[model samples]
Target: MTTTSAFPAANRPVGQVIVRASHVELYRDGQEVLRDVDLEVAKGEILGIVGPNGGGKTSLLRLILGLDRPSSGEIELFGEPVSRFREWHRVGYIPQHAVAFDPNFPATVRETVLLGRVAPRGVFHWFRPEDFAVARSATELCGLSGLEGRRVGALSGGEKQRVFIAKAIASRPDLLVMDEPTAGVDPESERRFYDLLGRLKDELGLTVIFVSHDLGVVSARVDRVACLNRTLVYEGPPRALHDEALLRTLYGGGTVTIAHSEEEPHTHGH
Candidate 1:
Protein backbone atom coordinates (compact mmCIF):
# COMPACT_ATOMS: atom_id res chain seq x y z
CA MET A 1 0.00 0.00 0.00
CA THR A 2 1.44 3.32 -1.04
CA THR A 3 0.72 6.33 1.13
CA THR A 4 1.89 9.94 1.15
CA SER A 5 3.69 9.04 4.37
CA ALA A 6 5.66 6.32 2.57
CA PHE A 7 8.20 8.99 1.78
CA PRO A 8 9.39 11.64 4.18
CA ALA A 9 7.68 14.98 3.64
CA ALA A 10 9.76 18.00 2.76
CA ASN A 11 10.87 20.14 5.68
CA ARG A 12 11.62 23.26 3.65
CA PRO A 13 9.25 26.18 3.35
CA VAL A 14 5.82 24.72 2.58
CA GLY A 15 4.57 28.26 2.78
CA GLN A 16 1.58 29.66 0.91
CA VAL A 17 2.87 29.75 -2.63
CA ILE A 18 1.26 31.41 -5.58
CA VAL A 19 2.28 29.28 -8.58
CA ARG A 20 -0.56 30.81 -10.46
CA ALA A 21 -1.45 31.53 -14.03
CA SER A 22 -3.81 34.47 -14.40
CA HIS A 23 -5.92 34.00 -17.53
CA VAL A 24 -2.98 32.54 -19.37
CA GLU A 25 -3.24 32.14 -23.11
CA LEU A 26 -0.90 30.44 -25.53
CA TYR A 27 -0.79 30.57 -29.31
CA ARG A 28 1.21 28.66 -31.89
CA ASP A 29 1.36 30.31 -35.31
CA GLY A 30 -1.91 32.16 -34.77
CA GLN A 31 -3.68 29.04 -33.48
CA GLU A 32 -4.76 29.03 -29.86
CA VAL A 33 -3.68 26.05 -27.73
CA LEU A 34 -4.20 26.94 -24.10
CA ARG A 35 -6.91 29.53 -23.52
CA ASP A 36 -7.09 31.60 -20.36
CA VAL A 37 -5.72 28.92 -18.09
CA ASP A 38 -5.49 29.54 -14.36
CA LEU A 39 -3.58 27.18 -12.06
CA GLU A 40 -1.49 27.01 -8.90
CA VAL A 41 0.94 24.56 -7.23
CA ALA A 42 1.63 24.90 -3.54
CA LYS A 43 4.94 24.19 -1.84
CA GLY A 44 5.93 20.69 -0.72
CA GLU A 45 3.52 19.17 -3.18
CA ILE A 46 3.61 17.03 -6.32
CA LEU A 47 1.21 18.32 -8.96
CA GLY A 48 0.46 15.92 -11.82
CA ILE A 49 -0.84 17.30 -15.12
CA VAL A 50 -2.77 14.71 -17.14
CA GLY A 51 -4.58 15.08 -20.44
CA PRO A 52 -4.97 13.59 -23.87
CA ASN A 53 -2.77 14.35 -26.87
CA GLY A 54 -2.66 17.98 -28.03
CA GLY A 55 -4.35 19.08 -24.81
CA GLY A 56 -1.63 21.72 -24.33
CA LYS A 57 0.18 19.86 -21.57
CA THR A 58 3.62 20.44 -23.11
CA SER A 59 2.77 24.06 -23.90
CA LEU A 60 1.89 24.68 -20.29
CA LEU A 61 5.21 23.22 -19.20
CA ARG A 62 7.00 25.55 -21.58
CA LEU A 63 5.14 28.51 -20.10
CA ILE A 64 6.09 27.58 -16.53
CA LEU A 65 9.71 26.93 -17.51
CA GLY A 66 9.90 30.44 -19.01
CA LEU A 67 10.94 28.83 -22.31
CA ASP A 68 7.98 30.57 -23.87
CA ARG A 69 5.73 33.41 -22.72
CA PRO A 70 1.97 33.28 -22.66
CA SER A 71 -0.05 35.31 -25.11
CA SER A 72 -1.82 36.77 -22.08
CA GLY A 73 -2.04 36.39 -18.29
CA GLU A 74 0.72 36.27 -15.72
CA ILE A 75 2.71 33.38 -14.26
CA GLU A 76 3.98 33.52 -10.71
CA LEU A 77 6.20 30.88 -9.15
CA PHE A 78 6.77 30.73 -5.42
CA GLY A 79 4.92 34.02 -4.78
CA GLU A 80 7.36 35.93 -7.01
CA PRO A 81 6.59 36.96 -10.56
CA VAL A 82 8.36 34.56 -12.93
CA SER A 83 9.67 37.39 -15.08
CA ARG A 84 11.31 39.05 -12.10
CA PHE A 85 13.01 35.90 -10.89
CA ARG A 86 16.03 36.10 -13.21
CA GLU A 87 17.56 33.28 -11.25
CA TRP A 88 16.64 30.46 -13.66
CA HIS A 89 18.86 28.29 -11.53
CA ARG A 90 16.03 27.93 -9.05
CA VAL A 91 14.24 25.54 -11.43
CA GLY A 92 15.07 22.18 -13.03
CA TYR A 93 13.38 20.52 -15.99
CA ILE A 94 13.48 16.95 -17.37
CA PRO A 95 11.97 17.38 -20.80
CA GLN A 96 9.76 14.86 -22.62
CA HIS A 97 11.28 12.12 -24.85
CA ALA A 98 14.73 13.20 -23.75
CA VAL A 99 17.03 10.39 -24.90
CA ALA A 100 20.76 9.99 -24.90
CA PHE A 101 22.69 11.47 -27.79
CA ASP A 102 24.69 9.62 -30.48
CA PRO A 103 26.25 6.42 -29.17
CA ASN A 104 29.54 8.08 -30.07
CA PHE A 105 29.00 11.31 -28.15
CA PRO A 106 32.20 10.50 -26.28
CA ALA A 107 31.00 11.51 -22.84
CA THR A 108 30.77 9.39 -19.72
CA VAL A 109 27.60 9.26 -17.59
CA ARG A 110 29.39 11.32 -14.95
CA GLU A 111 30.45 13.83 -17.57
CA THR A 112 26.93 14.11 -18.96
CA VAL A 113 25.52 14.64 -15.50
CA LEU A 114 28.21 17.24 -14.91
CA LEU A 115 26.81 19.12 -17.87
CA GLY A 116 24.14 20.27 -15.42
CA ARG A 117 26.83 22.27 -13.66
CA VAL A 118 28.18 24.03 -16.72
CA ALA A 119 28.44 27.82 -16.79
CA PRO A 120 26.03 30.81 -16.49
CA ARG A 121 24.11 29.65 -13.39
CA GLY A 122 24.61 30.61 -9.76
CA VAL A 123 25.02 26.95 -8.91
CA PHE A 124 28.47 27.16 -10.43
CA HIS A 125 30.13 29.77 -12.58
CA TRP A 126 32.57 27.14 -13.77
CA PHE A 127 33.30 23.49 -13.16
CA ARG A 128 34.93 23.76 -9.76
CA PRO A 129 35.80 21.09 -7.22
CA GLU A 130 32.60 21.83 -5.35
CA ASP A 131 30.63 21.38 -8.58
CA PHE A 132 32.21 17.97 -9.11
CA ALA A 133 31.35 17.06 -5.54
CA VAL A 134 27.76 18.08 -6.03
CA ALA A 135 27.53 16.12 -9.28
CA ARG A 136 29.01 13.08 -7.56
CA SER A 137 26.52 13.39 -4.77
CA ALA A 138 23.61 13.73 -7.16
CA THR A 139 24.77 10.73 -9.17
CA GLU A 140 25.04 8.63 -6.05
CA LEU A 141 21.68 9.78 -4.78
CA CYS A 142 20.11 8.88 -8.12
CA GLY A 143 21.72 5.43 -7.82
CA LEU A 144 24.25 5.92 -10.61
CA SER A 145 27.16 5.20 -8.21
CA GLY A 146 29.73 2.98 -9.97
CA LEU A 147 27.96 3.24 -13.34
CA GLU A 148 29.19 6.80 -13.79
CA GLY A 149 31.69 5.67 -16.38
CA ARG A 150 29.10 3.97 -18.61
CA ARG A 151 28.22 5.63 -21.89
CA VAL A 152 24.80 7.26 -21.84
CA GLY A 153 23.45 5.58 -24.99
CA ALA A 154 24.45 2.22 -23.61
CA LEU A 155 22.25 2.45 -20.53
CA SER A 156 18.70 1.12 -20.32
CA GLY A 157 15.62 3.36 -20.36
CA GLY A 158 15.37 3.59 -16.59
CA GLU A 159 19.08 4.16 -16.17
CA LYS A 160 19.05 6.92 -18.75
CA GLN A 161 16.15 8.65 -16.99
CA ARG A 162 18.01 8.45 -13.71
CA VAL A 163 21.05 10.07 -15.34
CA PHE A 164 18.98 13.00 -16.57
CA ILE A 165 17.43 13.32 -13.12
CA ALA A 166 20.91 13.35 -11.67
CA LYS A 167 21.86 16.09 -14.08
CA ALA A 168 18.82 18.13 -13.15
CA ILE A 169 19.42 17.72 -9.43
CA ALA A 170 23.09 18.53 -9.76
CA SER A 171 21.90 22.11 -10.01
CA ARG A 172 20.07 21.79 -6.69
CA PRO A 173 17.03 23.74 -7.82
CA ASP A 174 14.04 24.38 -5.59
CA LEU A 175 11.50 23.20 -8.18
CA LEU A 176 11.86 20.14 -10.42
CA VAL A 177 9.72 19.90 -13.53
CA MET A 178 9.62 16.46 -15.18
CA ASP A 179 7.65 15.90 -18.38
CA GLU A 180 6.79 12.21 -18.96
CA PRO A 181 9.75 10.64 -17.25
CA THR A 182 8.22 7.17 -17.42
CA ALA A 183 6.94 7.13 -20.96
CA GLY A 184 7.91 4.13 -23.16
CA VAL A 185 9.76 2.33 -20.39
CA ASP A 186 8.94 -1.23 -19.31
CA PRO A 187 6.52 -1.60 -16.41
CA GLU A 188 9.26 -2.63 -14.02
CA SER A 189 11.42 0.29 -15.06
CA GLU A 190 8.50 2.68 -14.80
CA ARG A 191 7.74 1.66 -11.28
CA ARG A 192 11.40 2.00 -10.31
CA PHE A 193 11.59 5.44 -11.86
CA TYR A 194 8.63 6.69 -9.82
CA ASP A 195 10.11 5.15 -6.71
CA LEU A 196 13.22 7.22 -7.36
CA LEU A 197 11.11 10.37 -7.64
CA GLY A 198 9.44 9.56 -4.33
CA ARG A 199 12.82 9.29 -2.69
CA LEU A 200 14.13 12.47 -4.28
CA LYS A 201 11.19 14.58 -3.20
CA ASP A 202 11.33 13.31 0.36
CA GLU A 203 15.07 13.41 0.93
CA LEU A 204 15.91 16.46 -1.14
CA GLY A 205 12.92 18.66 -0.35
CA LEU A 206 12.19 19.55 -3.99
CA THR A 207 8.84 20.61 -5.38
CA VAL A 208 7.90 18.36 -8.33
CA ILE A 209 5.55 19.07 -11.22
CA PHE A 210 5.37 16.18 -13.67
CA VAL A 211 3.19 15.48 -16.73
CA SER A 212 2.11 11.96 -17.64
CA HIS A 213 -0.61 10.06 -19.50
CA ASP A 214 -0.56 7.05 -17.18
CA LEU A 215 -3.27 8.54 -15.00
CA GLY A 216 -3.95 5.43 -12.94
CA VAL A 217 -0.44 4.81 -11.61
CA VAL A 218 0.65 8.44 -11.65
CA SER A 219 -2.34 9.47 -9.55
CA ALA A 220 -1.15 7.21 -6.79
CA ARG A 221 2.25 8.92 -6.71
CA VAL A 222 1.26 12.56 -6.44
CA ASP A 223 -0.24 14.69 -3.70
CA ARG A 224 -2.66 16.47 -6.05
CA VAL A 225 -4.02 15.87 -9.53
CA ALA A 226 -4.70 18.68 -11.99
CA CYS A 227 -6.55 17.75 -15.17
CA LEU A 228 -6.10 19.98 -18.18
CA ASN A 229 -8.01 19.95 -21.43
CA ARG A 230 -6.82 23.09 -23.23
CA THR A 231 -7.64 24.62 -19.83
CA LEU A 232 -8.08 23.60 -16.22
CA VAL A 233 -10.86 21.06 -15.57
CA TYR A 234 -10.10 19.86 -12.05
CA GLU A 235 -7.41 20.48 -9.48
CA GLY A 236 -7.31 18.79 -6.06
CA PRO A 237 -6.04 15.81 -4.08
CA PRO A 238 -5.82 12.36 -5.69
CA ARG A 239 -8.86 11.01 -3.87
CA ALA A 240 -10.96 14.08 -4.58
CA LEU A 241 -10.30 14.19 -8.31
CA HIS A 242 -9.91 10.48 -9.00
CA ASP A 243 -13.57 10.00 -9.91
CA GLU A 244 -14.85 8.41 -13.11
CA ALA A 245 -17.25 11.25 -13.90
CA LEU A 246 -14.57 13.90 -13.56
CA LEU A 247 -12.04 11.91 -15.59
CA ARG A 248 -14.65 11.19 -18.26
CA THR A 249 -15.38 14.89 -18.47
CA LEU A 250 -11.68 15.69 -18.68
CA TYR A 251 -10.93 12.94 -21.19
CA GLY A 252 -14.07 13.75 -23.13
CA GLY A 253 -16.00 10.48 -22.56
CA GLY A 254 -13.69 7.58 -21.95
CA THR A 255 -14.17 4.69 -19.57
CA VAL A 256 -11.72 4.37 -16.67
CA THR A 257 -11.74 1.91 -13.80
CA ILE A 258 -9.40 2.09 -10.80
CA ALA A 259 -8.82 -0.86 -8.50
CA HIS A 260 -8.73 -0.26 -4.78
CA SER A 261 -7.28 -2.37 -1.97
CA GLU A 262 -8.75 -2.71 1.49
CA GLU A 263 -5.33 -2.05 2.97
CA GLU A 264 -4.98 1.11 0.88
CA PRO A 265 -7.96 3.14 -0.18
CA HIS A 266 -7.70 3.93 -3.92
CA THR A 267 -10.17 5.93 -5.98
CA HIS A 268 -10.88 5.97 -9.72
CA GLY A 269 -13.41 8.03 -11.57
CA HIS A 270 -14.23 8.41 -15.22
Candidate 2:
Protein backbone atom coordinates (compact mmCIF):
# COMPACT_ATOMS: atom_id res chain seq x y z
CA MET A 1 0.00 0.00 0.00
CA THR A 2 1.59 3.24 -1.12
CA THR A 3 0.68 6.45 0.64
CA THR A 4 1.55 10.11 0.03
CA SER A 5 3.86 9.82 3.04
CA ALA A 6 6.08 7.49 1.06
CA PHE A 7 7.10 10.41 -1.13
CA PRO A 8 9.86 12.83 -0.16
CA ALA A 9 7.56 15.85 -0.24
CA ALA A 10 5.36 14.35 2.42
CA ASN A 11 8.19 13.52 4.77
CA ARG A 12 10.27 16.63 4.29
CA PRO A 13 10.07 19.79 6.32
CA VAL A 14 7.19 22.15 5.71
CA GLY A 15 9.18 24.76 3.79
CA GLN A 16 11.04 22.74 1.18
CA VAL A 17 9.37 24.15 -1.90
CA ILE A 18 10.72 22.92 -5.24
CA VAL A 19 8.79 25.43 -7.35
CA ARG A 20 7.44 28.84 -6.41
CA ALA A 21 5.65 31.70 -8.08
CA SER A 22 5.22 34.89 -6.12
CA HIS A 23 2.82 37.58 -7.25
CA VAL A 24 3.31 36.61 -10.85
CA GLU A 25 1.54 38.56 -13.54
CA LEU A 26 1.74 38.44 -17.32
CA TYR A 27 0.82 40.64 -20.24
CA ARG A 28 0.96 39.78 -23.93
CA ASP A 29 0.17 42.48 -26.51
CA GLY A 30 -0.95 44.80 -23.71
CA GLN A 31 -3.52 42.35 -22.42
CA GLU A 32 -3.16 40.97 -18.90
CA VAL A 33 -3.59 37.20 -18.84
CA LEU A 34 -2.44 36.27 -15.37
CA ARG A 35 -2.48 38.33 -12.21
CA ASP A 36 -1.27 38.06 -8.63
CA VAL A 37 -0.55 34.34 -8.82
CA ASP A 38 1.42 32.85 -5.96
CA LEU A 39 1.91 29.14 -5.81
CA GLU A 40 4.40 26.68 -4.33
CA VAL A 41 4.99 23.05 -5.13
CA ALA A 42 6.80 20.81 -2.72
CA LYS A 43 9.08 18.07 -4.00
CA GLY A 44 7.32 14.80 -4.99
CA GLU A 45 3.80 16.18 -5.13
CA ILE A 46 1.80 15.91 -8.35
CA LEU A 47 0.14 19.29 -8.61
CA GLY A 48 -2.51 19.86 -11.26
CA ILE A 49 -3.40 23.22 -12.78
CA VAL A 50 -6.94 23.45 -14.07
CA GLY A 51 -9.18 26.17 -15.50
CA PRO A 52 -11.53 27.07 -18.30
CA ASN A 53 -10.30 27.69 -21.83
CA GLY A 54 -8.29 30.93 -22.05
CA GLY A 55 -7.70 30.72 -18.30
CA GLY A 56 -3.95 31.15 -18.64
CA LYS A 57 -3.06 27.56 -17.73
CA THR A 58 -0.46 27.24 -20.47
CA SER A 59 0.69 30.78 -19.81
CA LEU A 60 1.46 29.92 -16.19
CA LEU A 61 3.37 26.81 -17.24
CA ARG A 62 5.58 28.87 -19.52
CA LEU A 63 6.58 31.08 -16.62
CA ILE A 64 7.25 28.13 -14.36
CA LEU A 65 9.38 26.40 -16.98
CA GLY A 66 11.24 29.62 -17.73
CA LEU A 67 10.02 29.55 -21.32
CA ASP A 68 8.40 32.95 -20.69
CA ARG A 69 8.89 35.56 -18.02
CA PRO A 70 6.36 37.11 -15.68
CA SER A 71 5.74 40.79 -16.10
CA SER A 72 5.61 41.80 -12.45
CA GLY A 73 6.85 39.03 -10.20
CA GLU A 74 9.26 36.20 -9.71
CA ILE A 75 9.30 32.51 -10.61
CA GLU A 76 11.69 29.99 -9.21
CA LEU A 77 12.65 26.41 -9.97
CA PHE A 78 14.58 24.27 -7.51
CA GLY A 79 14.62 27.32 -5.20
CA GLU A 80 16.59 29.45 -7.67
CA PRO A 81 15.26 32.32 -9.74
CA VAL A 82 14.15 30.75 -13.01
CA SER A 83 16.12 33.37 -14.95
CA ARG A 84 19.39 32.30 -13.35
CA PHE A 85 18.65 28.63 -12.88
CA ARG A 86 21.05 26.78 -15.14
CA GLU A 87 20.62 23.16 -14.00
CA TRP A 88 18.21 22.34 -16.81
CA HIS A 89 19.10 18.65 -16.97
CA ARG A 90 17.20 18.20 -13.71
CA VAL A 91 13.98 19.24 -15.44
CA GLY A 92 11.89 17.43 -18.05
CA TYR A 93 9.14 19.22 -19.90
CA ILE A 94 6.43 18.15 -22.39
CA PRO A 95 4.73 21.15 -23.91
CA GLN A 96 1.05 21.50 -24.78
CA HIS A 97 -0.13 19.65 -27.90
CA ALA A 98 3.12 17.73 -28.06
CA VAL A 99 1.70 15.32 -30.62
CA ALA A 100 0.69 18.10 -33.00
CA PHE A 101 4.11 18.19 -34.66
CA ASP A 102 4.83 17.02 -38.17
CA PRO A 103 4.12 13.31 -38.60
CA ASN A 104 6.61 13.00 -41.45
CA PHE A 105 9.63 13.64 -39.22
CA PRO A 106 11.77 10.56 -39.60
CA ALA A 107 12.92 9.17 -36.28
CA THR A 108 12.43 5.82 -34.56
CA VAL A 109 11.11 5.63 -31.02
CA ARG A 110 14.47 4.65 -29.56
CA GLU A 111 16.30 7.29 -31.52
CA THR A 112 13.91 10.01 -30.40
CA VAL A 113 14.14 8.98 -26.79
CA LEU A 114 17.92 8.94 -27.03
CA LEU A 115 17.74 12.59 -27.97
CA GLY A 116 16.82 13.40 -24.40
CA ARG A 117 20.26 12.24 -23.41
CA VAL A 118 21.87 14.99 -25.47
CA ALA A 119 20.72 17.67 -23.03
CA PRO A 120 22.06 15.83 -20.02
CA ARG A 121 25.16 14.25 -21.53
CA GLY A 122 26.23 17.48 -23.26
CA VAL A 123 25.83 18.07 -27.02
CA PHE A 124 29.48 17.26 -27.73
CA HIS A 125 29.45 13.89 -25.94
CA TRP A 126 29.18 10.79 -28.08
CA PHE A 127 26.42 8.30 -27.40
CA ARG A 128 27.66 5.84 -24.84
CA PRO A 129 26.51 2.27 -24.19
CA GLU A 130 24.85 3.49 -21.01
CA ASP A 131 22.80 5.95 -23.03
CA PHE A 132 21.24 3.09 -24.96
CA ALA A 133 20.67 1.29 -21.70
CA VAL A 134 18.96 4.35 -20.25
CA ALA A 135 16.78 4.76 -23.32
CA ARG A 136 15.79 1.10 -23.19
CA SER A 137 14.85 1.36 -19.53
CA ALA A 138 12.80 4.48 -20.14
CA THR A 139 10.95 2.75 -22.97
CA GLU A 140 10.04 -0.11 -20.68
CA LEU A 141 8.91 2.23 -17.96
CA CYS A 142 6.63 4.09 -20.39
CA GLY A 143 5.31 0.82 -21.92
CA LEU A 144 7.11 1.44 -25.19
CA SER A 145 9.38 -1.60 -24.95
CA GLY A 146 8.17 -3.33 -28.12
CA LEU A 147 7.80 -0.17 -30.18
CA GLU A 148 11.38 0.96 -29.87
CA GLY A 149 12.15 0.32 -33.54
CA ARG A 150 8.93 1.78 -34.88
CA ARG A 151 8.88 5.15 -36.58
CA VAL A 152 7.40 7.69 -34.22
CA GLY A 153 5.49 9.20 -37.14
CA ALA A 154 3.54 5.97 -37.56
CA LEU A 155 2.33 5.78 -33.98
CA SER A 156 -1.10 6.86 -32.78
CA GLY A 157 -1.62 9.92 -30.59
CA GLY A 158 -1.49 7.89 -27.40
CA GLU A 159 1.55 5.98 -28.52
CA LYS A 160 3.30 9.19 -29.42
CA GLN A 161 2.58 10.53 -25.94
CA ARG A 162 4.16 7.45 -24.41
CA VAL A 163 7.21 7.88 -26.60
CA PHE A 164 7.51 11.49 -25.52
CA ILE A 165 7.27 10.53 -21.88
CA ALA A 166 9.93 7.93 -22.40
CA LYS A 167 12.14 10.59 -23.89
CA ALA A 168 11.46 12.97 -20.98
CA ILE A 169 12.47 10.39 -18.41
CA ALA A 170 15.49 9.33 -20.41
CA SER A 171 17.27 12.33 -18.93
CA ARG A 172 16.47 11.14 -15.38
CA PRO A 173 15.12 14.49 -14.27
CA ASP A 174 14.13 15.47 -10.75
CA LEU A 175 11.14 17.57 -11.84
CA LEU A 176 8.72 16.68 -14.63
CA VAL A 177 6.53 19.47 -16.02
CA MET A 178 3.90 18.77 -18.63
CA ASP A 179 1.39 21.08 -20.31
CA GLU A 180 -1.90 19.43 -21.19
CA PRO A 181 -0.15 16.07 -21.40
CA THR A 182 -3.09 13.88 -22.32
CA ALA A 183 -4.82 16.34 -24.63
CA GLY A 184 -5.71 14.03 -27.48
CA VAL A 185 -5.43 10.63 -25.79
CA ASP A 186 -8.41 8.41 -25.07
CA PRO A 187 -9.79 7.85 -21.58
CA GLU A 188 -8.11 4.51 -20.97
CA SER A 189 -4.81 5.92 -22.15
CA GLU A 190 -5.23 8.92 -19.89
CA ARG A 191 -5.73 6.68 -16.89
CA ARG A 192 -2.71 4.65 -17.86
CA PHE A 193 -0.63 7.82 -18.30
CA TYR A 194 -1.43 8.99 -14.79
CA ASP A 195 -0.77 5.53 -13.46
CA LEU A 196 2.63 5.53 -15.11
CA LEU A 197 3.32 8.95 -13.60
CA GLY A 198 2.38 7.73 -10.12
CA ARG A 199 4.74 4.82 -10.46
CA LEU A 200 7.49 7.06 -11.80
CA LYS A 201 7.07 9.45 -8.91
CA ASP A 202 7.43 6.70 -6.35
CA GLU A 203 10.40 5.08 -8.05
CA LEU A 204 12.28 8.25 -8.95
CA GLY A 205 11.32 10.78 -6.26
CA LEU A 206 10.14 13.13 -9.00
CA THR A 207 8.15 16.31 -8.53
CA VAL A 208 5.35 16.65 -11.07
CA ILE A 209 3.38 19.71 -12.15
CA PHE A 210 1.06 19.75 -15.12
CA VAL A 211 -1.78 21.65 -16.76
CA SER A 212 -4.92 19.51 -17.03
CA HIS A 213 -8.25 20.50 -18.51
CA ASP A 214 -9.89 17.27 -17.41
CA LEU A 215 -11.32 17.67 -13.96
CA GLY A 216 -11.59 13.94 -13.37
CA VAL A 217 -7.90 13.43 -13.95
CA VAL A 218 -7.07 16.15 -11.46
CA SER A 219 -9.44 14.79 -8.83
CA ALA A 220 -8.36 11.20 -9.23
CA ARG A 221 -4.60 11.62 -9.63
CA VAL A 222 -3.25 14.86 -8.27
CA ASP A 223 -2.19 15.68 -4.72
CA ARG A 224 -3.52 19.24 -5.06
CA VAL A 225 -5.47 21.30 -7.55
CA ALA A 226 -4.97 24.93 -8.49
CA CYS A 227 -7.93 26.50 -10.16
CA LEU A 228 -7.08 29.45 -12.36
CA ASN A 229 -9.18 31.81 -14.44
CA ARG A 230 -7.04 34.82 -15.24
CA THR A 231 -6.05 34.49 -11.59
CA LEU A 232 -6.03 31.85 -8.89
CA VAL A 233 -9.58 31.00 -7.93
CA TYR A 234 -8.79 28.06 -5.74
CA GLU A 235 -5.86 26.07 -4.40
CA GLY A 236 -6.43 23.14 -2.13
CA PRO A 237 -7.45 19.51 -2.08
CA PRO A 238 -8.91 17.86 -5.18
CA ARG A 239 -12.18 17.14 -3.39
CA ALA A 240 -13.07 20.83 -3.61
CA LEU A 241 -13.91 20.37 -7.26
CA HIS A 242 -17.20 18.84 -6.24
CA ASP A 243 -18.21 21.75 -4.06
CA GLU A 244 -21.01 23.59 -5.80
CA ALA A 245 -20.12 26.83 -4.06
CA LEU A 246 -16.55 26.59 -5.26
CA LEU A 247 -17.75 25.78 -8.75
CA ARG A 248 -19.89 28.89 -8.78
CA THR A 249 -16.92 30.96 -7.69
CA LEU A 250 -14.64 29.43 -10.28
CA TYR A 251 -17.05 29.60 -13.17
CA GLY A 252 -18.27 33.13 -12.56
CA GLY A 253 -22.06 32.67 -12.33
CA GLY A 254 -22.25 30.15 -15.16
CA THR A 255 -24.24 27.05 -14.34
CA VAL A 256 -21.85 24.10 -13.89
CA THR A 257 -23.17 20.67 -14.65
CA ILE A 258 -21.00 17.65 -13.89
CA ALA A 259 -21.50 14.37 -15.73
CA HIS A 260 -19.21 11.49 -14.78
CA SER A 261 -19.05 7.69 -15.18
CA GLU A 262 -16.75 4.69 -15.00
CA GLU A 263 -15.13 4.81 -18.44
CA GLU A 264 -15.00 8.30 -19.92
CA PRO A 265 -14.67 11.58 -18.07
CA HIS A 266 -17.24 14.11 -19.19
CA THR A 267 -16.55 17.74 -18.53
CA HIS A 268 -18.23 19.99 -15.98
CA GLY A 269 -19.46 22.94 -17.94
CA HIS A 270 -19.71 26.47 -16.64
1-270, model 2: which lDDT tens digit per residue? 211122212222245699989999999999999988878888889889988889999999989888898999999888899999999998999988788767998999989999889898897789889998998999999999789889998998888998998899999998999999989888788878889999999999888999987886577788888888888887767877787766666666677655455375756657
| Model 1 lDDT per residue over 1-270, tens place | 212232222332246663777789998999989976767777667888987778899899999988888988999887677787676776888989775446566778999889888732444355779889999999999889999999888888888888889999998877899888777566677777777888887998788899987676766778877777887776666674456666676777767665433222233333
Model 2 residue 80 distance off true place after TM-score fit, in angstroms: 0.4
Residue 49 local lDDT, model 2: 92
Lowest lDDT sum, 10 consecutive residues, model 2, at 1-10
Query: Which residue runs does candidate 2 get wrong by more than 4 Å?
Result: 1-15, 259-262
Global lDDT scores for all candidate models: 0.76, 0.84
Best by lDDT: 2
As for candidate 1, its clashing pairs are: 243-269, 243-270, 244-269, 244-270
RMSD of each: 6.4, 5.6
TM-score of each: 0.86, 0.92
